[model samples]
Target: MTEPAADSRTELSSLLHDLHLISSEKPLPPPPLPPITELLARLKEKLIGASSDSETSSLIGHVERLFQTADPDWLFSLTSVNEEGRQEELQAAYRSLVCALIGCADLPLCGDECSSLTPAAYQSVPIRAVPVCSALRALLGALGNWEETGLLWSVAPPVCVFAVTHFQDQVWTNPPSRAAARSLQEALLRAGGWRDSTHLLVGDGRQREEGEEGGKSRGILGGVLDVLQPQLTKDSWQRCEAVKLVFAWTLLQLARPSLSPHLPRLLPPPLLFNDHYRPENCMLGARCLHHIILNTPAADLRQFNRAEVVYEALFKHLYSTETTVIQLVLSCLLDLLLVLEKPPSSLDPSSGRRKPCRHDDLLRLVLIHMEAENKVALRRVYASVLPLLVDRMGVAVCRHLRRVERVVLGYLEVKDPPEETNRLKVLEVLQRMTRAAWPRMQRRRLHMLLRRLLQLMDDVSSDSQLDDLIRDKLMSQTTLCIKLLHDCSPGNAQTLLLQVDSSCCSPEVLGCLETVTMSTER
Candidate 1:
C-alpha cells in the first residue's frame, strides 16, 4: 500500500470529527463523496494500526456516518483493488467494518462474549443507547443493500449470527431499534445469507464436538442456547422473553431435517416455557413445541423419551383455565401424541387386549373436562379438538363411548351463540365417533343421541337471536349427526322419529328429522 499524504490523514480526521458532532435527532444527508473513496482507504489504513478503544470508537462512528449518508454502491465499491488480491482485500475490509459496527452497536461479536451467560458479558460498558441503536441502524442500512451489490456475501454469516444472538430486549423492544434489527434480519435472509448463517450458527457434527470442547468454539446458535437454556426456568423465563422470541423467530425459519439434528438442544427451552405458570409464556411455549414436533422426524422425538417429556409438559396445560392457552396446548399435544404412538390404520386388527396408551389418557381427560366445562370458549376449544382426537383414536373410540355420548348430549343441550361454534364442532365429533365406533353405536346409544339432535334443532329454531345462517348451520350439522347415528344403528332413529307426535314437535324439527330419515333411506 502507498503511504498516504498528510492532507489525506487530516481530511479523514476532520471527517471523523464532523461525524462525531452530528446531531442524533435527524439523519445526516449524503454529503459530496468524491473523496469518500480515498477517505475509506485512509480509514482502512488507520484501522489496521488502531489500538486504543477511543481510536476504534472514533473510526466506527465515521464508518456509521458513511453507511447512513453515502450511497451503498459507492460506499462498498472495491474498484481500486487489483483483480489478483480483490477477494482478500474485500474480505479484510468487510470484516474490519462489520466488527467495528457491531462493537459500536454494543453487541457481542466475538465467541467469548457471545457464549457468556452473565449479564455483564452482554453489556460491554455504559454506552449511550441512542448511539448504539444508531450504529445498528447504519449497519442494517448497509446490509439492506446486499442483494443489489452482492459484495456482502463473505461477511453475511457472522453479521447474521451476531444479529440473531445479540439483538434481544434492548434492541428489539425499542421501536426504532426493533425496525432496524428486523430489517437487517430480512436483508440477511433475502440475500441468501441464511445458508452460510445456518452453517455458522448450527454447525455440523465435528464442529459441534469442537464446540463442546470449549464453549468458545460453539456456534452462535448453540452458544445462545447455553445462555438461554438456564434462563428458561419457571421463575426466570419472563426475564428471558426477548431472547426467546428472537430465538424462536430464527428457529422457525429453519425447516425440517435441518432442524432435526438440533432437537435435543432446541427442545428444552420451549418445554420450560410451556410449563410456565403464566398463560402468555405457556402459550408461547406450546407454539414452539408444536413447531418442533411438526418439523422433527418422529424417530428423533421418540429417541431418549423426548416425546414423553414434551407430552408431560403439554398435558398439564390441558388443565389450564385460559382458553387461549388450552387451545395452543391441545394443538401441540395432538401433534406430539403422534410422535409417541402412531394412530391405528383402518386395516389394523382390533385387539380388545391392547393397552390404554397416551391417546386414551388424553381423550379421557378431555371428555371429563368437556362434561363439566361451562365457559363458551373452553367448550369451543374442547369441542373443536374432539373430532381430530376421535379420528386419531379410530376404532379405539369405542372405549370412551359412554363419556363421549354424555359429552355429545350435554353440548347439544346448550346454545353457543352467534355462530354456535361449540355445537357445530360437537356435531362433527359425533359424526367421527359414529364412524369410528359403529359397532358400539347400537339402539340405546342411538336413541339418546337422536333425541338430543332433535331437541337441538328445536332449540335452535326457537332462538330468535340466531340469524338465518347460524340456525341453518346448526340444523344441518344436527341432521348430519342424526343421519350418522342412524347409519351406525340402522332403523332405531327412524323408529324413534315415527313415535314423536307432530303436536309436540315444531314443524322445523319434524321437517329436519324427515330429511335425515329420507337421506338415510336413499
Candidate 2:
C-alpha cells in the first residue's frame, strides 16, 4: 500500500483499460468496408517498387509471416479495446493486408516476368500492370477454390468466407486481384469447409453403391466442418454465429451447379441444425439457403433438406422479439419460397419430393410474425411468409385465419382489395392450402376459416391495399367456400349465398359475391 506501489498499480490499470482487456457482447457497429482501390494501390506500390529483389522477397515473406504470426483471437480482442474510430483504423490496416495477399489490384506480369520466372522467383516477382477484370473474377471464384490442407493459400476460404458472408458489400465493391483472390478462396475451401464426417469422406465408397449423393467433401472446407461441429453442437450461441456466417458465405458460393458437386459436406445437415430454431439462427439459415437455392442450379432438392429445416426452425423463432434475426428469418424464408421452390441439397433421403416435415410450423411462425408490433417487420414477414402459407394449409391454418379475422373485422371494410401486400401473400397461401388440401380438410374447420376471412374483409377500409388484398382473398375463398358448402349440403346453396352476402356487403366484395353466386348456381 505504499504511494509508489499504488501509483504503479493505477497506471497499469489505466493501460489495461485502454487496451480493452475486457470482452463485450454488446454489438459494435460493423467495421466499414475496406477501401479496395486505396488498399490495392498501396499493395501494388509495395510490390512493384522494392529497392532490390531481396527486399521484394522480404515483402512477400512478410505476407506469409502474417498467417503464421497473427492471432485472430488477439485481433478480435483488440477490437473491444479501441474506441470505435480507432477500431476503424485497425480494421483498415487488417483489410490492407488481406487485400494485398488476396491480390485485390493485380500487378502486371508481362514479357519474361510472368513466363521466365521460376516458381520461387515467380511468387516473389511483382506484376506492374493492373489486372482489375481478372481480379474480380478471381475474387468471386475464390469461394470455390478455398482449401484448408494444401499450402498457406488454402486457409483463405474461411477468411474469405468470413469476409464475404459478413462484409460482402465491401469485399465485392473493390477486390484486389481476381486470380489471386480465386486462388486464395479455393485454398480456403479446400483447407476448411470440405471435411465433415468420416461418412462424408469415407462414405464415398458406400454412397456410390447406394446411389445416395452429395456425401463426399474435403480440404479447408473439411477443416471448417471439423472446427464448427463442436461449437455448433454445443450450446455455444456466440460461437455459432461465426460458424453460421461462414456457412452462409459458403452457401452463397456453392449455389452454382458446377460447384454443387464439390460441396457434399454442406448438403447434409449442418451440426447446428437444432439451434436454427432461434429467430436469428433461423434467419441466417434461411437467408443463406435462399441465396444458394436461387443462385445454384435446380437439382433433386430432396438431398439438401434446407427448406424443411428452415421451416421447422423459423416456426420456433416466429414468436421471438422484433430483432434483425427474426426479420432475417422471415425475409429469407419468403425469398426462399419465392425464388427456389425445391429443397436444398442436404435433405434426408426418406422425405421424398414433398418436404418430410409438415409445414404446420411455418404456418404458425408466419401467424406470429403477422402479430408483430412493428409494421415494417410485420409487413416484411407477411410479404415472405404469406405466399408460402397460401401454398400450404392445415388444422393450425384455421387458427391463424381466426386471428386475422379479429384484426380485420374492426377496420372500415374496403371494396378495393386489401393492399397490405403481405396480406395478399396470406391470401395466396390460404388459397393454395385450400386448393391442395381441400379434399382432406374437415368440413367444420374449412367453414370457420372462410368465415374469418370474410370477417377480415369486413374490417379493413375499402380500396386500400389491405382492402384490395382482402377482396381478392374473398373472391378466391368465396368460390372455394361455396364449393365446400355444396359438397356438404347441396340443398343449402341459397343459405350459403345469403351468408356470403351478409359477410361481403361492399361493391368490390359484391363482385366476389357475384362470383360465389355464379359458382353456387353451377
TM-score of each: 0.70, 0.42
lDDT of 2 by residue, 196-255 (tens): 322222323222334332324222345445544454433442432234555555455443
Best by TM-score: 1
Shift in Å, residue 334, candidate 2: 10
How accurate locally, in lDDT, is each candidate? 0.67, 0.43
* lDDT: worst 10-residue window of model 2: 145-154
Model 1: what TM-score?
A: 0.70
lDDT of 1: 0.67
Clashes of 2: 90
Q: In angstroms, how far off is 85's CA in candidate 2?
A: 49
How many Å off is the CA of 139 in candidate 1?
6.4
lDDT tens digits by residue: candidate 1, 418-475: 7888888888889888887888887777888887877788788888889899888888
What's model 2's TM-score? 0.42
In model 1, the runs with Cα more than 4 Å from the true position are 2-8, 11-130, 133-175, 186-240, 344-353, 519-522
Q: How accurate is candidate 2 locally (lDDT)?
A: 0.43
